[model samples]
Target: MSFQKLILRLAWSVLIGGSLLAGSTQAQQLPAARDTSFTVRSAYLKEKKNRPSISIAQPALPPTVQASYNLTYCTLGARNLQLDIFYPKAKRKKGYPAVLFIHGGGWRSGDRSNHLPMAQQLAAKGYVTVTAEYRLSTEALYPAAVYDLKAAIRWLRANAKHYPIDTTKIAVWGFSAGGHLAALVGTTNGDKQLEGSDCNTSHSSSLQAIVDVDGTLAFLHPESSDYQVSERPTASKYWFGASQTEKPELWQQAAGLNHVTSQTPPIVFINSSIDRMHAGREDMIQKLDAYHIYHETHTFPDTPHTFPLFNPWFEPTLNYTADFLDKVFKAKRWAAKLGLSLLGDSEDYTCKS
Candidate 1:
């Protein structure tokens, strides 16, 4: 066996051996412990130190946007999955488009609160925005997070009447690990296998668009950082419950790139200079092109992986995200009115450092 495969084999053996000794029943009784090491403040501090002038964006509810926090969207046994919604207090005749923001923490850490500023800002722009919390790798495994995110989408649709949301115009935007989930949720719309059995099954979980902020599209792709096997167990390993070698199929199933089809919605990629953060993006874009799907890519040079949480890059990220959503949703509204099938234009732009 190859060195990488050997290491993965050993890692799996150690993980399984430890779990067995701990007792399966004992493990199931309690929710897995969350990795709380990663947070917006920690990320901001790290990035701020790297660049002295950079500032962390504070979360604030603008006067025009009203927010409802800790609203339960789903309940798994004893665990209550919650989300925060920020929407314009002013009503609109046709209803406002919606965007669900997912925060990234390698699937093991980070909270929905990380994206509060983004959600608040987007709500001020006349879109109903949500920041949702999901089961992390510590609490659940691979498909659990996916299932929870889909439920959040369905929850939004189910409560559209209450929130004045234009159910037809909804998008998912996520950062890092959350970005991976967002893309997976966007591509796997209507996919029965990934769609969990519970939580507002009557309402569709389909998304009109996806914004993946530096999230990898494919976990198993050659260009992916996830493919690089290590002696120590990685975050993906924890989430998958095994090494890539032990569960290649699970890794591939979780990859958004594997699920892309003609019916997949338009996607915009906002990436930092880190190439590893966007592994499998180019290949996914190729698939998007084959299907004539609309997509855009914006790369910010010399920025941290968590650039969206800080200033300098933060405003640009917000603008790009809002502009892209408006373009896609507006085109959809026009198409619906005119009865014309239209796909928005695609572009690739790089922000100079």
Candidate 2:
């Protein structure tokens, strides 16, 4: 292994004076954990790949980074839930702030690999980025994808040490269908109904921040924009398994806007100016303002639905996202959770009073 890969390996090893192996990394979040403990899943680290040098801010460095692909984060009913992880070799003992990238396909068809270019670009900029695959509506339904991503979050935290990651600074970025999932994961932080079974339950699925690009926020609309939703079964039927009238509760529950609270993480909405995708956005922004949580929005006038994920618009999308995340990662709430690098040796120092 190269030095970068070696540093990553050292980072993953059991931290000295910490808990034993095999336990979940829940202790990273909970204070007085009677059962929760730091953990290490060696299986996830067994495979790693080094890619060619990719230039970003400056000229190319010889050894750039490595990507660990198809690493199992969870397994449910004959399918293995996996994710591709990319981390730069720019050694940071404090690890890198991670963003779990979810793809978009109306909650039915989309592969995690679609975000590979985005992940590589983001990773080159100094953040650990993960592109994850979740159980779709076909394989599951309603909150199964939610639970899958949540489980992925827990699994990521569980294996934080193995990769250069800051457990507290985790964020989520999604486009379209993935955007809804991202919003769901970000807002439904503590709700147990959406949280699924047996995937690293110890750690939090809640995000420190989110980037929702043209996702469906509120299904309930009052004809404010060009888009329209039918009262009968429609696009959402694939995921919800019923029409809005048949399962009003499920529709309401699945709307990311309904779950937003004062505690919802800072978010940026990169939307197409003509799109009505953010149906309940104004109301949710009011809730966000009521709580004084940081938020912003950037709309591309006359752009298509996938503008944020494509060229031209994608440039601004990347800038806005990176900037927002850079700021969010440094916020007091997230910074306070920094283990060592962000805090430095001073965290180990105490006054000799």
Candidate 3:
């Protein structure tokens, strides 16, 4: 067995005991490096061993933007969390804004790679984009993923020189399950668990803007009663660490809606009417209004949750996100408003080819 695999096995045995924690809760074993006639050696090492490292030089002359893949950073457990970075490649350039993306799979089964196409699309538009990977459900739960996300933000700020990231202007975009995570990260300002270790040297997980794509926002709402899963209680249980009825307080604590405040980041929360899972988006937006936080809510006709990425609403949604970012980052007086008026008349956001 490889030494790292041995150590990992021992460590996990101690943490997980005999049985798996729950659904999709299996840890991926590191491959053993050496094997005998009856033993199996590493199956994946050939690719890593053969690939040559191409070091991308920081462009001496300023370019409007640049993109790179597979930038890695450490998470709370020292797991090598990887992210893809997109930014302006030129020196003397205005530190372009940064956007971190989290994917959706009920907090259990998504990857940073799923956001690759989206990251590349954004990177092409002069914004620094990072598609990040956080530990999944089978291995960890609840706050573990949040911790990794916060660590990613901190790592980006600390290593601003490594990429052309704007520390002062940061945004988070998440889809479905990821939308809930993005909202939670943006809403939770001083959460100690989400804070990075002493090595981190940047501001907190407070984002300048939040883009929620078909995610649940409230823990106590009747909306989530629709997701009936047998193996797991509900999607909320997988995400917030408790069944809503079993532990209301814990659910509320993790619910992004519960964390809203005047200081909450400007948010663009979107969902499709055909997706029953997001029945709560309107209610959540109402709550955002109560808190006097600036936000925009959109619903696409006949489209299901998260389908905006490829369906008819895809281009419109992307354009809305880009426009929303510009308004939130540049507008000062309107930042204090919580009404739909902050969107500057609904006609401005009307879908157009």
Best by lDDT: 1
Residue 45 lDDT (model 2): 27
User: Which 10 successive residues of model 1 have the least lDDT summed?
Assistant: 344-353
Query: Which residue runs does candidate 3 get wrong by more than 4 Å?
Result: 1-65, 75-78, 90-92, 193-203, 226-233, 239-242, 332-353
* Residue 341 lDDT, candidate 2, scale 0-100: 26
Residue pairs of candidate 2 with colliding backbone atoms? 12-161
261: Cα error in model 1, Å: 0.9
Rank the models by lDDT, top first: 1, 2, 3
> Clashes in each model (backbone N, CA, C under 3 Å)?
0, 1, 3
The worst-scoring run of ten residues by lDDT in candidate 2 lies at 35-44
Residue pairs with clashing backbones, model 1: none
The 0-to-1 C-alpha lDDT of every candidate, in the order given, reads 0.84, 0.68, 0.63
Candidate 1 structure quality by residue, lDDT tens digits, 286-312: 998787777889999898899999888
Residue 79 displacement in candidate 1 (angstroms): 1.2
Local lDDT at 212 for model 1: 97
Q: State the lDDT of candidate 2 residue by residue for 67-110, as single tens digits.
A: 88889888654456789998988789889889999988767666
Which residue pairs clash within candidate 3?
24-138, 25-138, 62-90
